[model samples]
Target: MNDSDAINKYHLSVERADGQTDNLVVSEGHQQPEDVASTRLERVNLRNGGNVDYQEFALEQEMILKARGASKILQVCVMLPLEGAYSMITPEGEECHFTPNQGFMFRYIGEEVTFTLPGHQTVRSLGFCVSLDVFKRYLDNQIPDTIKPMLQPKEIGSLPVPFQIDNFMRETLDRNLQVEAQGSLKQIRWEGTALLCMALVEEKLHKAANPETFSLTQACKQKAEAALELLMADMQDPPCLADLAQELSITEKKLNLIFKSLYGDTVFEYLRSIRLNKAKNLIEQTNMAMKEIAWTVGYNHSTNFSKAFTRQFNITPANFAKKARKLTKVS
Candidate 1:
């Protein structure tokens, strides 16, 4: 079969699509009933003829990946929550919230996990799956001695603390997601990106003197999370920073710091990023007019929206929509 057909056949399988919203569901071990909301997925087979797979998914909603019914043998799950919050729940009931721009490393041999995403907004995430042998082979020389032991195949009670996704890391991952290649070249590109991402994760995790295990007080965590939800809910006209702080009964300075600490960006930066991503999705998934889409996303003028879209993605709204339509046809 051709490359596109091959990708469709092996790269992804959607159990069901929500007619109203674009959703591609993936469950643990490829089992039924587990839902993962994603609009795009690419599965790449290793070039060395290995059984390992390098996969990426762009999620659109919060989903629950059940652990009890999983069928596949998962060695390591390297996760990047590009745009939304995530909760990783262990079988023992230990749960932690992962903020945006944080990388999660999950070893799933002896442990069972249920991953849940936010239900309100779109969450773009990238995941890499590898066998235990494959993981050790690739990182044996690269990983430092101190962190090497953690890589050993074993189950633990708690999930490893997440690390920051710095500017350089963000650029690399974003570029990889936008890769446009065909056939063997596509596979090679994916493999290289996966290794690079893995290396980044290791480097960041190693440098962290103390990983954040979500030790924040339960009340504070819930309140801070509620603040995030409020901001995300209204993209066109979100609450002012001071108003948000007052609503949460916190100082503006403290609120800003909390957002920056949890997510790697300020409140303004995060909101702008979310808005641009929403615009991109609308361009790709809907046939709405530019003016209407702009207004819907909270941009008062089409020109302003186009300018922002161009600045963020380096593509004009019209051009992006045209290309998206073409790709939809080709796929």
Candidate 2:
């Protein structure tokens, strides 16, 4: 599909740091953003490049983003949600939740890719996109080859692929975020960052797709990180180890090893740490009751929840909430 078929794209008006305006269609295949009042954005900027467009923004809301009807254009998108998690319901009705450090790749095939943000946390997201025309030249070596599989146009409703955003990319994004370049210099810096990310992501995905005899590749660690997202997707009733292993096409023992080697914990222990961290945020930020917080984070009983919370943080949930509320009142 050509540019004409790529209608329904969102037009993000951009003003460079040097104070000039640009009207570029950065994201395609999704309709113009609707229900705008319900969402809030602190800042958003789009920068056009030779073959890629970089978009950076911070979002604070909890809403299901809508999509348009099916079309022919296939847009491969890379999104890194640095501070929060989002759920994407694929067009075929499969749902996947992507949390921080769990970057995702998907071919936006002219359908709705719903992203819902919970926990009422503010997250900064960095996104990069190359149009189909630009993406199709992998055989000609336009974009990095690692992205070829990810950029491959798929049938409608293909499953979203998850990847781990490693420490290098994280630190690179940090430095890129701090750059104060103006005009064309700004474009050079960010677009370079975009391609640099492309190389790293490609290498990571290549490892994940082709794992030899139980080796410890960055890609292996990346797949483990992806598993973490799926494991915690439904804290209430998550999939079992067998199921997760089947999804990754590895044995249960190997899956546990990946988690152990990369994260230094068994799956259960890692999950406990994550659950308690989420609960701590809830106690400090939201007004939800102890039982509600407990259940939300997968605890079945408040007594057990209080015990675990105290064990994790050295303070009971009730007292923690009370102290947090008191501090709120004081401030």
> Using Cα atoms with residue i matched to residue i, what is each candidate's TM-score against the true structure?
0.50, 0.51
lDDT of 2 by residue, 169-288 (tens): 665775776688776786576666666666666666776776534578887787788788997889988788788889878788777778767776557667878999999999888999
Summing lDDT over every window of 10 consecutive residues in candidate 2, give the lowest-scoring window: 37-46
Which 10 consecutive positions of candidate 1 have the poorest summed lDDT? Answer: 4-13
Among residues 3 or more apart in sequence or in different chains, the pairs in candidate 1 whose N, CA or C atoms overlap within 3 Å are 236-298
Misplaced by over 4 Å in model 2 are 1-8, 11-61, 67-72, 136-156, 211-331
Once fitted onto the true fold, the runs of candidate 1 whose alpha carbons sit more than 4 angstroms away are 1-38, 47-62, 67-74, 110-112, 153-159, 210-331
Question: In candidate 1, how many clashes are counted?
Answer: 1
